[model samples]
Target: MEGYAKLSSLISTDSEFAMYRKFGAQNTQSLLCYQAELISFGDDLQQLAASDRRSQDTDKRLHAENWYELSRVENGKDQQIKKFDKIRKDNCLIQQTAIAKLDRLAPYNLRNLRRWLTRSAFGSSFLYGLEARAWDEVYDHDLLAFPRSYAENDKDALPQLFLGPLLELFHNLIGRLYKKGTTKDTLSPEPLIRYYDSNILRVADILITIISSGLPIASITALNYINRTITRLVVVAVFTVTSSLFLTFLTSLRRTENFAVTAGFAAVQVVFVGTATGAGNGGLLRSDV
Candidate 1:
């Protein structure tokens, strides 16, 4: 009775521990509940950390990709700019070179006509003929394209007249002197000098005025000879032939001692020489002659 009374008093005093005192049931239940709550909180924290890590990785990847793309675009643009700059520089250099060349040529070109006039009579006549022919060709070409204006009309004329034909004439004449078939040095300076004195300067001045006034000379077509190889070799030949013929005719007339015969022979010689000289100067003399 004394033991039973002690046990009953302990149980009544500790209600929470009453079951544990007998079998530990209530204490175990409370411990299990607290453990479950702790586990749930730990799992919640781990999931939150994992989600944060993934979000940071995605942001980093996006930033890196954007930087790479931006760099590529900038590089491409830089290449294009460099290409354009190089092209612009090349064009500028070409333009500058052309301008420099043109400037260097101006003085020589300006003096050509005057220089040719002073060269020799044959040279002057030949050059004058060449100039006239070139002008005619240019005029004809311009007239074909713009028929309303005459060849003398500057407004409708082709620029080729001023640029191409004039330039070509000088080039061709110089080239002819240097060519293999013609022994230019063998030519007697006397006839050329005489021809120059008689015709070259005046013709050059007249040509210059006509060209400046944009008028085609009436004599231009008469001067422009056709392409003939023999024509070039005949000038010196004609001069020699005419002098020989005149001397022979004079000797014959003096021997005959007849005034009428002498006059007739003289007239014949004059006609023949005049015709030969004209033909030679006009470049119409045959190469075989």
Candidate 2:
């Protein structure tokens, strides 16, 4: 219960856990390749920069200097300013682009689908699931269940722009009606009808404003909480029924365990209502009764 409360709080504060918890992602980029390629590029540039001809510089003379640019010149002098400048510009552009690619964050994700393709060729995937290094690959267990992702499209849009969950209900219904697949190798669940919290939160806020504006709400603090609970009361009912149906459909749990979980969920809501009532409305109860 405590963990779930924290999770709900986290979902509202930062979309970070929401992305990881309810979406599919991958780790495909290779950090090793990125580092190696960047190093190779830098080494080549350094070797050219340090090159000196005449052989007078001893071993410090790299690439023989003269041999560094052995390509035949088209129509310029042995080394003209125009040709050299153009060549330098071209090489710098290429190198800069390569550096930018290497600096990208995607390449460091070694757990993506690219690792599977690498299993046969480079054997780099042998260290998968080792958990030794940050760059090391790991099993796709956490991500396999989420093969698809929803980004900004998943949020509820105001004024009827986006309706993610409501539309998903139709997609699920159509897929089943069409009998889309021939095989039953996998499972396709029809998710419970879900409504995002934005609307409910807005409604709750409006009700609080109305109650507080009309009365001295500090004296009726418990009443305010009770009103808030009543706003979500329908949602609690839906969750209880849906949870029971899904539990029976998916799990082999004995009846006792199922009843306990189902009842507990409802009881938590009722307990809140009862607590708020107990705090307020002393006149509703009598010692004579």
Candidate 3:
């Protein structure tokens, strides 16, 4: 009976041991399945991370491309603006040249107007002193050339010959002034009137009358035209230089903006690299591990 009891105990213990082994094997299989699932989840997460990285890279690439395209567009726009501006400026310069030429051809009565205005005002009287010495010499010579002797010389006969031409010249000038009505507005102050009290004007007028009275009308006219032409040439040169410099400045500004866009794209690239590297280095391992 004791032997049978011992055998039964041994069998029970063996059965329990076998049951424990079976349960352990089932648990091990469950753990293995859980590990496999975790591994699959990790694989999925890795795939997602890789996909996110690729997406980010694609986004960055697209952004960079967009920036590059924008830079190209800006550059093209800048060039176009410069070209259009140049054309417009050239047209304006041409118009100015045409106007200048037309002005040169138009013959306004500038000389006649100046003479009439100067004569009507006290400007002519201001110039009387300059010829006073020469007039005195002429009067003295006239007295000596009188028909009668100096003892029989009459003041009327002596002075009439001397003053007649001078009075006639004054009357002729006065008649011209009378004919010139106040038709036109004053363009500039008359130099004769402005300098009526100036001794310099008398001195200059006397010198000019002595030196230039013998000059032909044609020579005077040619000299005046030369002076006018030189002034017009100077105006045209200034306009051309100013227009060219302004255009150059505008072109440079546009080019600078275009280059700035390119630099912005480069900066974007740098940021993308830093962000991608930082993301890769950060912890992205499976939580299950």
Candidate 4:
């Protein structure tokens, strides 16, 4: 239900979206370059783990042949290597950690990414940007796609996940469209992109208030003349489902959390229906007297 201004004006004044549009490529490149570094690091770790002089190989020889002390005295083998076994523990830890880091790195899929980003930004309207960057040489990070898309699960980080697609989509759609449009008009600054999360939170708070308090009384009043029992149940059910979906899409609530909120919402509606119905019935009975 967003109203739109003149198309030419919109094209001219939209600056924040333009910034993000430009940011998409740089962020994607930065993300990829950073991933390349992580891959190189993991590969190097694998090489170190694979080398012949690795700790595990030393452990096997030391444990099997009791070669803790080398035949050549200058080799300076650890006489207590088998007894302490710290080297093997260190080697095991390295291998385990390397496997974990490698698993986080997935093959790049621009197609899936495009779909996800579009979906997150409300079918290419360019609502808000995400914060997604997977990793780099100095840091390995998790992917975070809230209201996560299909390709984006619990993993993924900023710049790569959110900001990347959000910006790219804006550029591809708004940026491209603006160029062909008349130069005399431009879209104004986009507050939606600038204060996206805050706007979402504010809307969420308002929705919560409506669902918890307003809807209950409204439903009762609307359905006051209907078959009290069946109509109230239907109204309550509809409110529950709609609110559940709203929370799911707009906020990052889990299924259980949504359920709890929905349950409370339904409870209020049920209480309103019962109390109002009872009061009406009592009034009618007194009138008969």
Best by lDDT: 4
- Whole-model Cα lDDT per candidate? 0.36, 0.41, 0.35, 0.47
The segments of candidate 4 whose C-alpha lies over 4 angstroms from its true place after superposition are: 1-76, 79-175, 179-227, 248-250
* Inter-residue clash pairs, candidate 3: none
- The digit string of per-residue lDDT tens for model 4 on 1-289 reads 2212432243234321211122334555665665575566566544533452445555433433444333333444434422234323434335333434433322232333334235533223333433332222222233211122323322323223333455456657775555443333323322222223333334445545665476556666766766567777787788778777766764566789888988887787778778878888999999999
Candidate that scores best on TM-score: 4
lDDT of model number 4: 0.47
Cα error, residue 20 of model 2, in Å, equals 9.3
- List ranges where model 3 is wrong by over 4 Å: 1-77, 100-108, 116-289
Query: Clash pairs of candidate 1?
Result: 20-24, 120-196, 121-195, 121-196, 230-287
Candidate order by TM-score, decreasing, is 4, 2, 3, 1
Name the better of 1 and 3 by TM-score. Answer: 3
lDDT of 2 by residue, 55-86 (tens): 46443344344443433334533333243454
TM-scores of the candidates are 0.16, 0.22, 0.18, 0.38
User: What does candidate 3's lDDT look like per residue over 33-109, in tens digits?
Assistant: 65575566566645544554466455433432354532344455533234334444534334333433321110112
Write model 1 residue lDDT over 244-285, tens digit each, in one string.
443343233343444554355345434544665587666744
Q: Please say which candidate is ahead in TM-score: 1 or 4.
A: 4
TM-score: the better of candidates 3 and 4: 4
